[model samples]
Structures are given as C-alpha cells and as structure tokens.
Target: MVRRRLFSVNDHFYQGKPRYFIAECSNYSCFCVHVEGVQNTSCRSYLLFFVSKQRRLFKFIQPRTQLVATQCGVVKRIFFSTGELSGDLQGSILIRALTREALSRNVVVKVRRYISRVVVKSQKTFQLYGLGGSLMKQEGLELLQDTSKISSIGLIEAVPHLWASWSMIQNAIERVIEDPPDIAILIDYVGPNLQLASKLRKIFPGLPIVYYIAPQEWVWGYANQKVPFLLRYVESIGEICDKVYSIFPAEHAYYQRHQIASEYVGHPLFSSDWKKGNETNQKRARESLQLALDAVVIALVPASREQEIRYILPIMAQAAKHIQDQLVDEDVVFIVPCSRDDFRAKIQQQLTRSGVSQFRIYDKTSSSIVIAAANLCIMKSGTVNLEAVAMQVPQLVLYRLSNWSAWLGRNVLGLQIPFIASPNCVEMRLVVPELVQENATAENVSKAALNLLRTKHEQQRMLTDYERIAKVLHCPEGTSRAAKSMFELMQTD
Candidate 1:
C-alpha cells in the first residue's frame, strides 16, 4: 500500500519574484520545501517526491500540480446583511474597522471581485461579501445584492416591494448556502434580517452569527401590549445570533434583560471625525454653499428612503413655504439635502410644486455640509436626527406613515413609544420636538421650525440637550471596539 500527500504553495513574492513550494512525501512523513525565485513555465508545476521504505529510496513525480494557495492559511468568509443608506454607511465603517482589526491580528482581507490575490505576512484571509449598497461596495464588500434603494419604513409602504424583497431573500439564502460564510453580520433593517437569521440558524446550526445595530424592539416593547411581540423578537435574535453589539446604553441593557449575549459598543457615528463641527466649520460650510455667513439656513432632510421621500417631502416642502412666509424679513434660506442623487428630481418637483422659491437642493455628498451650515433642520424621524444633533443643529423631527399603517400600528399592534427621534430616545426626554403621524402636518412642522429659529432660549436648550446626548453616545473608536469583539467571536472554537 502507498500513501499520498498534497501541499499548497503559499502565493507570495520574494524580492519582486514569485516563490513556490514543493512537498516531499515519504511512506510515514511529509514536509514542504520552499523554492525561491522560481519562474513557472505555466500555472501548474511538477514536484518530484522520494519515499524511503525499509532503507530503500523510491522516486516519484506528481503530475499537474496546481500552484494554488488553499493550504496556506485559513480563509474566513464573512457575510454582512445591511439595508438603507444609513446601514450602508454604518456597514462601510464597520467593514473598514474589521479590515483594520484583521490586519492587526495578522490576517489579510481580500475582495473577491477586486482583489485577485494578496501576498502578505498573515496566513489568514478574510473574504467579505453580502447585502449592502454602493458605499459598502466601495469599502471592498463583494456585494451579493444591493438593498439600499429598496428599503421601506412603514408596513403599508413595504407592501409594494414584498415580492421583490422575498425573491432577494431567497436568492441570498441560496447563495449563502452555496458559499457558506464562517460568520454572518446582520446590521439594521430588521425585517428581512430577522428572517434571514432564522433561516441561517436552521441551515447552519454552528455558524457564528452577529447582530449589530439591532432592532429598536426595546423602544416599542415599552408598551405592555407589545411585550409579547418584543419577547418573540428578542428570543429570535438571542437564539440566532452568537453575539449582539448594541450602540445605545439602553439597547444593551434591554438585550441583557432578555438574556441575549450582547455588548454595548456605543454609536458608530462617534467613531469618525465628523461627529461635530465648530462655528468656523459651519461658516466655511455656508461659504461653500455660496450662502452668507449670517444667513439662517434651514435644512430639510426628508430621509433617503423612497417611501419617506414620497410621504414626507411634500409636507416638508409645504412647511418650508410656511416658514418662508413667516421669515419674510430675515435672510432665511431653505435647503433640501437630497440623500440620494435619484431623489433630487422628486425633491425638486415637490419643492417647486409647493411654490418655494428661495430653496436649493444639495446632492447626497453635501448632506453633512448642509447640516453643519444649517441653523435648524426639519427632517424625518430617523438616523438623521442623530446627525443633526452631532452638528448641533436644533431640529424638528417629522414622520408620516401611510394612514392605514399608522392606524394599524396604533390600534392593532398597540405600538407606543415616548420618542421617535434617536436623540430624544438617547436622552430619554424631548431633546427635539417630534411631529409624528397625524401630528406631522405642514402647519405644525413649520410652526415648530419657526419657534426653534426665533426663540434663542429654546434653541440653546435643545443644543444643551444635544451636547448631553452626544456625550452619552460618544465612545472613542466605538466601531473599532465592535470589530474587535466580532473578530474575537470569529476566533472562538
């Protein structure tokens, strides 16, 4: 009987030349010998092996030996599930953090489509792929699908895209099964992610799954009537995920109460240098927009989602008209920060149709600049609220769901929450005025915006609240900490 052994050549370059390795196998032992500066005639290399048995040496040559690096190190495929523009941004940041942390741990990260082969000192390679947007792709995520454009908020709003979403989920599951990931990271966009997690848990029982920026069931779970649903949600997450990284202190506590393996990693917004801006930066931003430094700029952020743009932009436009009518003497300019380039035409039409003349539309790239330059913001109740807070811009949060969806949520689902805006939720108080559902009328929103703009005391009070909230959410290198935790989880036996 004869024994056979195979060895992989490490794909590396030595002094600007490719290196190869040959394996020598005997009847009882096998070892690899490195050959430097070997020029391969073709992709395949032949290795001659000698076996010693009973003090006799036998010579053999292996044919068609492929110069591949499979046995060089461990290859960890990580799948990331994220949705919406905010999730895309967060996912990008987290991806960067993960890459950095991996490098620190002597692991190399390679994007399948962009990177063919990477030669590094690390023996481990992390291949990242999954559902995200262009921003995540830019951060080197081999995207399975793009969910940014299709994300919807309310139940009624999501109904139209249900079939497409289901199809996407099915396709994702099929792909994931075909090329299984060693770890899965689920960001926000709770609906499909929860479903995906449940399916993955059933399919791959031992797979390490993580939930980052988990659902806000804790906030809605405050209602006694909603506790059952919240419990189910918590249990589903707890059962599916190996770890849950919470961005908020309250979120961490809530998960812990439910006995979910969780850690508070703080908000990812604070991980970057764009957390807050000073007056000088504000002035510079205004100047960049060709606006006078003293001009009172009111930013209208209707959100990035298509349903949100449809339901909220018109009302925000109408509110801008009302605000313009009230601030006739002051140099107040209304600017709509388009979160997506495709949404610009819709926003323009809505603003124009609303008869607002002194308004400008900025592309997604200029959103932060517009926020920094703004005196106040009239926006939807979402992650942008926290962004406005970071910029120290007093804002009036407005959200309008479909009438049917709102009714169902209030009457059937019994959804109750103290605050809709993240800043308010973080502070556990009314940091910014929230006009939600029926209350988010043009007149009400404009009135609130005018009050914030005219009343210095109110603006100062909100600014103070924002400072406190920022302090609470500010954890240095928060995303990095989360990546470190996730990497450690990936290393568990």
Candidate 2:
C-alpha cells in the first residue's frame, strides 16, 4: 500500500498569511505557505513567497571548472565570466574556501551565477582544480563529496547571455529569502555583481553585500559614474557592515570621495604564501634557460590577455633585438611566461612574421620561479608586476590599452596617475620602468631592460624599495580579517 506522508518542518506554519521556508524533508527545495483562511486577493495578513531551488547540489556550468578554489563550502558556484578569469584563479579559489569555512559554522551559503542548474553541497570538504577546462561532466563532484565528507557542492551552469546571469542571480536571492545566509560576499566581476546587488537589496533588503577586489574605476576614470549604484546597495551595509574592506588606503579615499563608507583592510596578494624564492631554485631556473652563470637574465613578461598580446608581443620581440645589439655579450635572454598555449603561439607568430627568433617562451615554470631566476624583469603592468615585486624582481613595466579607449581616457577623463603599473602606483613614484601608450616601444622597453641588466647597483636599490612597498601593502590579518568583517555585518542584519 502506498503510504501518505506529511511534509515535516519541525515547526508550526502560520495559516493566516503566506510564508517562506525550505522543505528540508522534501529534496530541500524552497516553498511558499498560502493562508487557508483568506482569499488569494485579500491583504489582511497576506505575503508573497517565491520558491527557488538553491545550487548546493549540482555541477559546474562548464565541463571543466577553470576557476580557482582556495576555500571550501556547501555551495560552489562560478562568479565571473570565462573571459574575465584570464590569468589568475585566486579570487575564485579563495572565496570557495571562505564559504566552506562559513558553512562549517552551520551558516547556509548560496552561490549565484548566470546559470540555470541547481547545485547543492552534500559533503563537508571539496577541492576545485582547473585541468585546462576539461571537466569530467559527472564523476568528479561525487567522488569529491564522498571522499572529502563535503555536505553539498552544486555545479550549476547558467544559460548564456547577461540576462541569464541576472535570472540566475535573482533565483539565488529568492532562495536566500527562504533561508537567509550570514553574509553575501560578491567577489569581483563588477558589472554583473552590481546588477545582482541591486536585485538582492529589493528582496533581502537588510542583507549586507561586500565587494571584494573592486573595479578599477579610478583607472577607468568613471568612479563617479559607478559610485552611486555602489552606494545604493552598500548603504545599508555601510551602517552595520562591521568593516567595509578595501585593498588599499587609496581605495578608502575613493569610497570617501563618493561618500560611500569603507575601511582599509589592506591587499590580499601579500597575505598569500608570497615568500622569497630559494637561491637554489633561482640558480637551477637560470641554468635551464641557458644563461651564463655571471650574466643577469632579464625576463620579459607581456600581458596575458589576447588584446594586450596583440599590442605588446611585437614590441617585446623588437625590444629583445634592441637589447641584444646594445649590450655586447651581455647574455640577456627574453623569457616569456605565458598563461595559455595560445599566448605562446601568438608570440611565436609575431616573431615568425617579423623573421626574428632569439628568445624562449616559458610555460612549466611558475611566475615565482621566473622571478627568482631573473636579475631584472620587463613585465606588463598588472597583477604579475605585483608578483614580481614580492619575489624581489626589479622590473621595467609596459602597457597599452586599446587605441580608441586610450584616446577617450586621455581626452575626456584626464587620468590623474601618469603610469598604469601597480608597483609604481603603490610607490607613488617610478620605482620601476613603465612604458605606456605611445612610449611602449621595442627600443624603449629593450633599452630600459638592458640598463637594469648592466647596472647592478641600481637593481639592488630597486629591490630594497620593493621590500618596503611589500611591507606597506601586505594585509596583516589575511582572509580572516575581511571574512570577520563581512560575517559580522551579515549576521547582524
């Protein structure tokens, strides 16, 4: 005989008004309670309850998860677009770990993306690794869940297009209304995040939203345009958000300028295992690169993104030639550490097209290894430059934005900072070489690179300065400090 079963909530339901709650005994899907005493149109004690399925139980949208996973949690979701994931997977990884930690404390964490699948975590631990984006569609998640004791980890894929992202994000909010989390941490990916925050405020009006690794509005020269929306969603968070964290003191100024409240929590990069490289690794890497024992190896790292590659690769090839000619028997080898194989192909194509071949491209070697091996580095000014500084590699920085965009930046916005490199920005001085826009030429970069290779005293001084900068930027409390601040606000709300 088929037996009838009642949905067990271990709590009483109010029959006079609509209510929201998770059906824990019934696949844990969100549900609404309709008042039996009142008509559907009656407003005496009626409420709206939107049932939404959470992602603590599915698989990644893509076949392979390309995002970095530093922390573990009950729900695993992708935050940014594949295009934005570009070089570093740190933010994704870090957040995953942080979420997992929160979940261990019995906090219900929900991950929102631009996908349609429901992801739920049934295990207490999980490891997320990127295998060149070739994810096993079915097997890995279950294996991880069983072995690691992970309670739930949903690998939900969103539908394509920005609207789909909005829909998925909205669904996450609806789920939160049924089961509120301690805090909502939106990690980077500014455009979609901003929209999600706005939608969330409408539903979970009191929920605190913390922005991690904020957009470079100052660099984009449009902090003014974006600040208001940021304030609107973050305003409630501001009053009770234990601490609105910022990566730098300058960022606090931006928040203050816009009248948006924030606290200077310091940079995350420095808090990682950013230790100096061993002398032995440096010696071994130099030997593998085929440099003379006494000769200084000047590593040349251009930007990893496709657009940046187009403008920077040619300049690097030319710079290599220039340096070779200027410093007679200087033994300066151009080592390019590429993020993807296509980056290597692009650089090779540029050199082949120009009939030049005098450098080697590095892949197996980590950036830290490259930094340790180099006497000096000529790098594209982005996150990599910061890595170089932490590794004590004195650098000559070069960067070029899209032509049309550069024109608008120069003409309309009038950028305050003369240089684009973060190391220079942190120092508020040209502590390293920066050749931007028209100045990022082969001759200019090569000349600067060669100068450092020959000048030992200057390189040493630069290293000393880098050490100082590292000390200033390093976050003392690490992820816990930021996590605590965000958690306090989320719980209080």
Top model number, TM-score: 1
Models 1 onward score TM values of 0.81, 0.64
RMSD each, Å:
10.1, 12.5
- 262: Cα error in model 2, Å: 2.3
Q: Residues 1-493, candidate 1, lDDT per residue (tens digit)?
A: 0111122122222223232222222342222233444456333343433335453535433443333333323455689998998998789879888887776764322111122332323333567899999878987899989998878876688898888788888999988876667678999988889988899888777678899989887775443335535325787887788889998888888899889888887887766623432223688889888988888789999978888887898899999999888878888888878888888888888889998988899887677788888988888888888878777888889888889988877777666767888987887777789998889999999888888887999999988988888888888888888888776655521
- List candidate 2 stretches off by more than 4 Å: 1-87, 96-183, 217-243, 256-259, 273-281, 284-295, 354-356, 489-493
Writing each residue's lDDT as its tens digit, candidate 2 over 1-493 gives 1111121111123323244342222234433343355432212222222233453633223322111112222222222211132212334334433554555554232333335333343343222221111111121311111110101100111112445445545655554444344344554444455665666556544445566666555432222333323324344434333334577666667666656657676666676522322234567867766666676576778755556676777887778777766766655555677655657788777756654445667773355577668877878767778878777878888887667656655555544444577877776677887888798888788778768876889989898998888888887655556655544443321
lDDT of 1: 0.74
| Position 481, candidate 2: lDDT | 65
Query: What are the clashing pairs of model 1?
Result: none
